[model samples]
Target: MSDRAVPATPPPLFDTAVVAGVGLIGGSVALGLRQRFLARRVVGLDASMDVLREAEALGVVDEVRISPGEWLREADLVVLAAPMRALEPLARELAPFLNPAALVTDVGSVKSGIAAEMERLGVRHFVPGHPMAGSERGGVVHARAALLENAVWVLTPTDHTPLTALSRARTLVEHLGAAPVVMPPAAHDDLVATISHLPYLASLALTHMVARDERLSLLAAGGFRDLTRVASGDPRMSRDMIVENKEALRCALERFRRQLERLEADLDEPEELLAAAYEGKRTRDSLPVVKRSLLPQKHDLVVAVPDRPNQIGAVTQALGAEGVNIKDIEVLAIREEGGALRLGLESPEEVQRAAGILTGAGFEVRGRS
Candidate 1:
């Protein structure tokens, strides 16, 4: 039940991974790669030496560097984990240092601008990746091993991108315990603008609207708290994301405004509007719950089980018998011969219960506190 007791195998892919920027996403990727892939060398680069040292001390990376230019040439894959505004400049700086065949990816929230810059720089091996995961928290200190597990990682590759490079990039993402979904550069931007960028703007605006009124702040409760939670994000990073994806975000905002106006106009017909809203909610809730990328909580666990018939059922049953409820479960690896199953349980107690059952049933289990 615990991450350490799981018998997950390393990914069969590249050995060396260099993360540029030891922030939340970057640090999480480094941790996932090192833990899941058993990467030969996981190196981290950051603008702040103190942050770099912290990342190394946290064991997210085997080593640390101050600049991407110093390590990019030798790394099999280079991941830019900085803010969107930094991606374009960093891409230009790293383009020359990158190995001709090495795969390059980024964790920037915005894709279109960075993708364009990569294309212009003739970075043939580039794959623009946006892991649709994160928390309001930022920085290396919040980096989590299961950050990308089961989360949708979108990659936008252009025609000029080499097939081999894209394949390797996908392998790297898989190794980091993420699900890679491919799309065109433009489409990726458009989709994220609607789902991601617009939401951030709305959250911030909602918070501002409440905070501006002294009396409203005092009356705010669970609904307002939950809705404005993401507004607590790092201002610099949020600003960068909004600016980098300005055009798409602007269009998304306009569409959202129109919807709001329609609802206001229908306020007189309360019952009809309520029914329409209820129908919309039903339709929205019908969609599959995509696993979101989130910082690992203190009591979380990642478990791995073999790819065998009835294995999942057996494991779930074993946990259920022990009264342990699984918070989340992901098939980290699935091969014809064997695979890895990662599970996130609610607490260490649940993990211990599940671990005892699975191990008693002859399954190898790893646990991470």
Candidate 2:
């Protein structure tokens, strides 16, 4: 990204913006652009007429089309939200139609492959992006502007990419409520292999381990369910992501294997095993509440509430009533009877005010440890 600072009042980034493959990520981008009036017209392109109709019905886009045509020539911004395999082809097909000044980007998880393809194609304005925000559910029905809120959106710009184009892409990312992070495409792939791909495979492995025995499966509780949640995501999508970055993923798996071997060797040494567990806990505790750096810093308050109708809503309502805005939220634990929720606030002052509000409303509130 360029070093130029965005003015306090930046004009709309583009006159016409287009999003291809209007699925969860694509639809979310279209919605964000439309909601913020970042474009004069938001167009949705997909091979499925059904999807186009649904996006139109949901007001996710101002117009829908089956393919890129002459109108694409007017677009100042085009987001290729298609599958990883299809991105290169789609970019190639739309190249001749796009305005010379138009900025192009993608939401593909694996960046190195697409970055190389774009560089080879001489797509000067392209910026490869991966928004670290999504849900297990797929489709436009799950798309919403809030999905990208405070999320870290990574942009991988090749050496051929223009700085002005990168800056504009970053501006669009910020408008969608995401923090922009720039890094080499290879570095992005290597890092995500450890943080994302490996964890997903680990989730799958753990789920299979417990599921192999009916007795253990029947006893599975919240912790087991939470740990294996990613295994429940769309299997096809997971397969594609894992395979696309197999080289890095394999290296990550080898590192994990070594760690597991060390743990097994420490089984007979109780103190060593305990220390290993302690170190793991300390490292986990140091992760940011939200995955990025914030200026004022974010704080948290864990509120315990009964598992009743509207219980979660009541907690949020109480804080909202006190004008304490929530930055983010996560359910730490939930059982049939009750659960504890971790509410992220903007500052220590907001945390204090929120705690008082929830406690006044008859819910137990405590600061995050």
Candidate 3:
């Protein structure tokens, strides 16, 4: 054995990141890399000049490229945040432009299709990633800086994927303050099929079921609204996810059908079924709560304040004067008197600073734990 101590190599710094689709996920990722990693430059490529312009105005990227094929040659990291159907074609188009050593990844919810395409294209550095963070709303307009914060970002690396590329991808995810979990591609598909794809179909079905009965719309309340909320998501994107993950989704649907059948068979005794459902709720509630610290941590401050115009602006302005960055803000509640607002800060010290500034400014501030 050699006596010399081998020095650890420094993390690879991406010279430039190219996001192929400047929609919500792509725009958000570009913004995150620029803000968190201090990336030298970030370029966005989109077919829509309007979206490209919007992305530039939003500071999601340093520059926008009208043509994706031309910019792919220079990117150190190429992220495909396009729809599932576009991935195969995009990979084929990008293969020749990509540097042999550069890393390639996609934010597609389905991995098997993309991975198979990458294999066919002979792309050695490709890694399949899915960030489990999104809202029912779509497009760059709704893209948030803290969208990926504390979210479970899964990486499904195939046997052919290069280890160095996988490490770099994980580093990129960590830099964005996301929790990274690794699993086999098939397993990842199966898991997401159950958790994500199934819910989407169920939501759509629930929405359709209600739409058939015009009178049901008036009867719809909190539970109906909450359960079918995701049905409001982009129809195109939902269609893509369902088609791309068809096999896994089919299996999941079968399981769900069996459960529904059992419930239908037990429906004669409505009270017993209702009691069983309550027991199910109790079992779910009995599960231990996931500790906050166990998840990725971020600095945040919550404040209880009167519901009035300009109060938020005042609080934010005070913090801005202190040079503190506000990642996100949520107006939690509002009554005739007051409401609670939660502000996500960039650091714990900044949260304290914001609390002090708001409190001194005569607003009731709550320091979040």
Candidate 4:
């Protein structure tokens, strides 16, 4: 079996889709569905009238509903894209309003608690999902049609879940240009605890520790800011995710603490610390890199460039001179020292050549292929 869910062209997967919250994630899902023509009519059901209006105005949804009862009955695919903590209560309120045949899923970060809540409420068609894509920003204004494109959209289903419901969820994921991976809810929570939740806590801890020191105000720069970017996301949502997966998070914290202790113990051993550092860089470099696509296909090449005039022009000129066509380019991030510039090429073949060209030009290239 393939490790990744195959992306298949989607037909009208559902007659209507009702996104529960029109925030960054929910709005993005609605936008993705509309872009793909996955739903004949897309509806927005959010508690915030302002958000619903904004989403509708942005064309993320075909129509806006003040209440779930207004559109819930007609919705064959319902996306609950609220925060983790609100899901249970939202489910309770939405349970009586759901169509018996409607396939319900969510875009929450943690799945175990949401899955348990779905089971507790006797929701047979519910699938728990966590899209491996987000930003420090929130709200409909920041939402994009390509937000979930080429990203991993994980769906966790129980053994009791009907295959049709599971398939429907997967098809929607594929329609959004995302790879769907199915797993048990508990496993999903455990994995994300280390990779997702723990990282947030670590960033927050770092920020908390460093920010209190007024002496480091001028000292902390590029590397420090880059490492702590996760701590800059919605604080309330981060806290909720951490608390919801505290059991798995506890285990992750213990492992992290042991690593920290080892580093402390090896403070005087320069070779040992250097070995640890190399191991980290090796592991990070081993992972597959997929960029959010602007065109139909994309291969991202991120270059670490100095913050000076003509640097971007020089990068583009190098590509032009090498006969490499640039499909798209973007400024991924900017630090106090330099900026990380991302370029999307047409094919994987262009990636290495571009990296080589930049490396030759004395640019620090991080090939994200």
TM-score for all models, in order of appearance: 0.79, 0.75, 0.74, 0.76
* lDDT per residue as tens, model 3, 1-369: 755322121122588888888888887788666654324678898878999988888777889988757567778898998877887887887788888777899999889889888988898999999988887777887775468766788999999998898998897787666778999889999998988899999998988988899889998988999888878888988899889899999999999999788889879989879987998899979965422222123676656555456666767877899888888876642444444556888777887888788777766554422
User: How well is each residue in 227-255 modelled by candidate 1, as lDDT tens digits?
Assistant: 87778888888888888788999999999
Give the top-scoring candidate (TM-score): 1
On the 0 to 100 scale, the lDDT of residue 243 in model 3 is 90
Candidate 1 lDDT score relative to the true structure: 0.78
Q: Which stretches of candidate 3 lie over 4 Å from their true place?
A: 1-12, 268-279, 282-369
Write the candidate numbers in order of decreasing TM-score. Answer: 1, 4, 2, 3
lDDT of 2 by residue, 199-252 (tens): 999999988888788788878988989999999998988889999999999999
What is the alpha-carbon lDDT for the whole of candidate 2?
Answer: 0.82
Q: Write the per-residue lDDT of candidate 4 for residues 107-173, one digit (tens) a residue.
A: 9988888888888888899989999889889998888756787899899998878898999888778
Distance from true location, Cα of 23 in model 3, Å: 0.6
The C-alpha RMSD of each candidate to the native structure, in angstroms, is: 6.2, 12.9, 11.7, 13.4
